[model samples]
Target: MEYMNIINQIIILFLIIIVGFIAGKNKIISQEANVTLSKILLNITLPFLIISAFNFDFSKNMLKTAVTILIISIFVHGTLSIVSLILYKKQEEGVRKVLRFITIFSNCGFIGYPVAGSIYGSEGIFYAAIYNVGFNIFVWTIGILIFQSGNVKGKGLLRKVFINPGIISVSIGMTLFVFSIKLPYVISETIKLIGNITIPLSMIIVGVSLCGTSLKSAFKEGVYYYASFFRLVLVPLVVYFILTLFKFKGIYLGIPLIVSAMPAAANTVTFAQIYNGDVSCATKITIVSTIFSAITLPLMVLLLK
Candidate 1:
């Protein structure tokens, strides 16, 4: 039953992607417009989404769980970074960079919150939000370095890493969570309403990205299948087993497992465009892994149950 709900949500998201793909194919969303959309998503909607995730009422037990999740999230990302670095070292440089980035970062924000909420409700979102802190931190720091390697040096790279929207929003969200600061009802709702655009908008952008690339070409790259396997199958299985070894079960185990299993971050395409990485490769990996997740996610849920 819960697995059906997960499938339904994914199908809805995929439908939105189809909408964007059709629009892009018809030239409704031009290349220039897609670039602008990416900027809007990264700077505007994503930040609000991050902030709104922290809007729930505070409790000591929740706070404790939040802290635990934060620590685990950081450790998981760090481990994945090392693993990706070692695994993809022999690939071509451009593809290597994007592969490492996508493998290390999943679609935690755009897909994770809703899916987590569906299964665990508000409590699930809280864990997703907390886990995202580590995600934001690593993505800004190490993830940027992956894209910018040898291109931007020293202070330029540092500026990009430290001053991005991801870090800023994480900072704001974490401050609110730690201090238990509540926005007035209207302000919170407004933030959430805007933040809600992120998922659909992200999917549309991904669809737009897929416009020119054929399904054959998209799957032509064998490396994409390798990356998808790492992202959708291996990562979640490793996370689930590791957490269980530590006796972390229920929501703690489930939330991280789901988040880790998510497809390549949609931001892979956005960031590739921003940093002049391999945009086509990014799109292919993201879409392929996402399509494959329809099978893997339900399997993960069944395992969780």
Candidate 2:
């Protein structure tokens, strides 16, 4: 029954994505509108979710767990960076940059929070938020550096890493947790309601992005397949087993695995656009990996659990 429930959760998420795909195909939502939705998600909804997640009472063990998970997450990204370097050593500069970025980062925030909440509720999201601290920090710093190939000359580097919504929420959330601060019940509840919009909105954005892409050409790149396999399957399984070997149990083990298993982040295209990388290649990998994740994620959970 637990296994069935997990599969159902994955199916429900895919169905939501399908809605966005249909909307995109029928011109129900234009690209400009979708961009607006994405901004709302990152700037507003996700931060609320992060704040609400910190409603848990503090404990020494919880702090320890948070730290451990943070370390593991950094290690996971660092190791993937090495793996990507080795695997794509001979590729062209643009392909190498995109491949390295996509392989190193996962869609931990947008997709991860909802799936973790469905399976493990608030506790799941709490850990997801912690894992995301590492993700947000690394992606902004190291990931951006890779994407731009160290083009940090004139960009507001500090603002990009420290002042972004994700890091801001993390900062606020951690402060609340450490101080045992509580918001008014009404305020917390309202934030909770707003945060709930994130899941469907994120999937819809992904689905809409998939609408006009040449799926065949996306798959035509043999390297895309190799990268997808590495992103969707190989790395997550290795991380899961490694965590298990260390005796990390329950949601601790599961949350990281799910986050690790998310397809290439949809932000790949955004980064490509910003850094003048291969936008088409980034889109193909992002869409194809996400489509494949609907199958791979549930299987990872079922087997790992």
Candidate 3:
């Protein structure tokens, strides 16, 4: 039953991506329009989603679980960051940088929360919300730093890491959670309505991005396959088995498993473009890994059984 549910969820998400792909291919949405959509997603809708996820009735136990998940999240991402850095140490500058960034980050916000919430309800997104705290921190800091061929900008590093939209959302969400404060019904409902746009919009952006890429290149590169395999299969499997050994059951166990199984984040390409890394390689990595994750994610859920 759990397996079927996961399959259903992935199928639904894939269908949505196809919608975006078709829209992109047919020129229903122009590149400018797509960029605007991406901005709306990251800046507006995603923050609302974060806030709404924390809008539920609060409790001591919930707080504790959130903290526990945050700790585990840090551990998971930190471990992977080290592993990727070590493994990619000998590669060329550009490829090595892109590989490291994609390897450490996953689509935890766009894909992770939706799949997790599907299986585990709001509780899942609640945990996923906290899991993203670590994600936002590292992605903005270490993730960006990895791709920069030039000298590190130490001036605003602290500001950059702590002041992003992701971290800001997490902070507001945590404040709401910690204070047991609830927004007015009208306001909260409005936030929820906007927040609901996040998943589809994010997936559409991904699909649109994919429409311009050469799937052939994504497959032709042997390195792409190795990186995708490490990302979509091996890393998640390692996280799962290790967590199981410690007997961390329930959402504590499941959240990490779901997150670890997510594909390379769509922003790998975005960050690469911004930081002037290997944008083509980043796009290839993002697209190919996402395509493969549809298969690996379900298998990972089955293994959880």
Candidate 4:
């Protein structure tokens, strides 16, 4: 029964994605305006969602869980980094770089928060935020180097890692969580209301992004399936088994598993564009992996039961 609820939630989220697809096809969400919507989601709604997730009363166990999850998040990324590097080393330079980036990062924020919130409520979002702290840290640092070929340097690199929306929002949320500081009722409710916009808005953005790509071309490359298998299946399965072996269970095991199983980060396309990588290849892989995840993610959730 519980697993069925999870499946239902995933189906609903995907239905929203279909709406965005139709909207994109109908020109209801123009490509230019989709970019603006992405900005609003990243800079505004996402941060509020992070902050609002921290509104619960502080507890020692929760704090310990947060710290533990943060460590696991970093460890998972570090190991995946090494694994991805070796896995794709023989591919052409342009395709290799994008493959590594997509393999190492997942769409943990946009899809992660909403799914976590649905499953574990505020506590799920809280831990998802903690897990994402490691994502922001590595993504801006090592992730940038992958595409830039280590050209980015100095204080500029540090600023990008530390000053981005993800890190900043996590810092604010952590501060509130640690101090047990409560916003006034009005402010708290307002933040929650704004944060609620994140789920459908993000899924719609994904749908619109997908609508712009050619389904035939996106799936034509056999390499896209190979990479998606790693990103959506092998990585998460490895993480789940290893963590369960160590006695992690319930949300501790579940949240990380869900995040690991997410599609390639949407930022894969954005970074490929910014870095002059193979933008077409990146888009194809991202779209293909995301489409596959609609099947994989629900299966991942059912494993929790």
Best by TM-score: 4
List the candidates' TM-scores in order.
0.87, 0.95, 0.95, 0.98
List model 3 lDDT by residue over 112-225, tens digit each.
Answer: 878887778767887898898888878877887787644567767778878888888889988988888888899999999998988888778777877878888788988888
Better of 1 and 2 by lDDT: 2
Ranking by TM-score: 4, 2, 3, 1
Query: Could you tell me which residue pairs clash in candidate 1?
Result: none
Q: Is candidate 3 or candidate 4 better by lDDT?
A: 4
Listed per model in order, the count of residue pairs whose N, CA or C atoms clash below 3 Å is 0, 0, 0, 0
Q: Which ten residues in a row have the lowest lDDT in candidate 2?
A: 153-162
Worst 10 residues of 3 by lDDT: 147-156
Better of 1 and 4 by lDDT: 4
Cα lDDT tens digits, model 1, 1-305, are: 36667667767877887899999999999868998998898899878877887776667877788888999999999999888878787788888989999889998876776677667765676678778878877887788888887554668656765687766876787678778898888998998898888778877877787675677788888889999999999999999999999999887898899999998986888789888788888888887887787678778877686
lDDT of each: 0.82, 0.85, 0.84, 0.91
Give the least accurate 10-residue stretch of model 4, judged by summed lDDT: 81-90
Per-residue lDDT tens digits of candidate 2, residues 1-305?
A: 28788788878988999999999999999888899999999999999988888888888888898888889888898888777767787788888889899899998877888888878878788889889878877788778888877778645876787788988887888888988998898988999899888889988988888886888888788888888999989989999989999998777788889999998876888998998888888888887888888888898888655
The TM-score measured for candidate 1 stands at 0.87
lDDT of 4 by residue, 142-233 (tens): 78888998898769889988898888988988888889999899999999999889999999999999988898999888899999999999
